[model samples]
Target: MPLASQPAGRRERNKQQKLDRITAAARELFAERGVDEVTTQEIADKADIGAGTLFLYAKTKGELLLLVQNSTYADALAQGKSEAASLADLLDAVMAILRPVVECNRKQIDNGRTYLREIIFGDPEEPHHRDAIGMTVQTEKAIAEVLQRDERVSADDAATLAHIVSAIMFVSMAATINIAKPVDEIVAEIKDQVRVLLPK
Candidate 1:
C-alpha cells in the first residue's frame, strides 16, 4: 500500500485516546487548582504521559487551557443554539445563544483576566487555536440561522447582522465581566442594542 493508503486507523485512534487523556487531566487540574497554579508535569503525571509528550500536544500552559476548554466552548455554542430556538423575539434569541458561552468564559475569567483575548483568538496555525476559531465560526453561523427565521431579514442582511452581533457579544462580555460588573445589566443593554439593530 502507498503511504497515503496505509490503514493507520489504529495509530490514529491511539493518538486521539492519548489526547483525550491529556485534555481530561488538564481540565480536572485546572478546575481544581486553577490554571495558573497547575503545572505541566502535574498534568503529564495525571495523564500518565511523559512531560515531553505533553509539551508536544500543548506548547504552553495557555495552550493547555485552549486544549481543555475547546470542547466546552463548542458544547456551550450547541446548548446556546438549542435554547435559542424556543425564543421568538430576536433579542431573546440572540441572548439565549450568547449566555452559556459567556458563563463558560466567566469561569476562567479570574486567571483569564489578562489574556482572554489571546485565548479567544489564538494563532490559527496551532491545533487548539484552530479549534477555537472553528467554534467561533459555528457560533456566528448559529446566530445567522436564528436571524434567518424571520422573513423580514434578507440572507445577506442576516449574515451582516450576525457579524455585528458577534462583535457586540464579545465586546460587551469583555467590558462588563472584566470589572465584575452585573452581567444581567449588560445583557439588558445588549438586548436594547439588538432590538434597534434588527428590523421588525
Candidate 2:
C-alpha cells in the first residue's frame, strides 16, 4: 500500500513540475514577444516538453496566456491588498489596490490586452479561463473592502461601486485607443473615472 501511494505522489510531483516549467517558459516568451508573436511550439520547446504535452496543460495560446497572466495578476492583487491596509484615505486605499494591477496588465501591452480578451470572451468552462475569472473576483472583493472603509457607504453600495470600478479598470486597459499610452497614463485615466464615482 505504501509503495502504491508513493507512485501516486511521484506522478503528482511530476505533473506539478511540468506545469511549473510550462508556466515559466510561457511567461518568458510572452514577455520577450507579445502573445501574438510567440508560437505554441516555441513555448513547448522552451519548457523542454513536446507539443502534445503542452496541449494537455493548455489547449490554446489564449489559455496559455491566461495561465501565465493569472499568476501575476494574483500577486499584484495580494500586493495591493497589503498596501491598501495601511491607507486610511478611501481614494488612496482604492488606488493602492488598483495601481499594481494596472502595472501588471501593462507589463507587455499586447499580452495584457489579449489576457483581458481571453477573460471576457474565452470559454469560462476552460480551467485557465476559470482561474482568470477567479482572479477578477478576488480583485473586486479587495476593492469592495477598501470602499467599505467609508462609513457612509453601505456594504451594498460598496459592492456595486467595486463592480463598476472593475469594469472601468478593464476597459481602460483593453481600449485600443489607449494602446500607445504608458502605464501611468492608463492608471491616471482609471483614477479619474473612479474619483467621479466615489461618494463625497
Q: State which candidate has the highest TM-score.
A: 2
lDDT of 1 by residue, 54-159 (tens): 9889998878888877787878898999999999987788889988877777666644432356556667788887877777788888988989888988889888
Report the lDDT tens digits of candidate 2 across residue range 92-172.
899999999999999999999999999999999999999999999899889999988889888999999999999999999
TM-score per prediction, in order, is: 0.84, 0.95
Model 2, poorest ten-residue lDDT window?
A: 1-10
User: What is the overall TM-score of model 1 with all chains considered together?
Assistant: 0.84
Q: Provide the lDDT at 136 for model 2.
A: 92
TM-score of 2: 0.95
- Name every residue pair that clashes in candidate 1: none
- Tell me the spans in candidate 1 whose CA falls farther than 4 Å from its real position: 1-10, 111-115, 119-121
lDDT of each: 0.80, 0.95
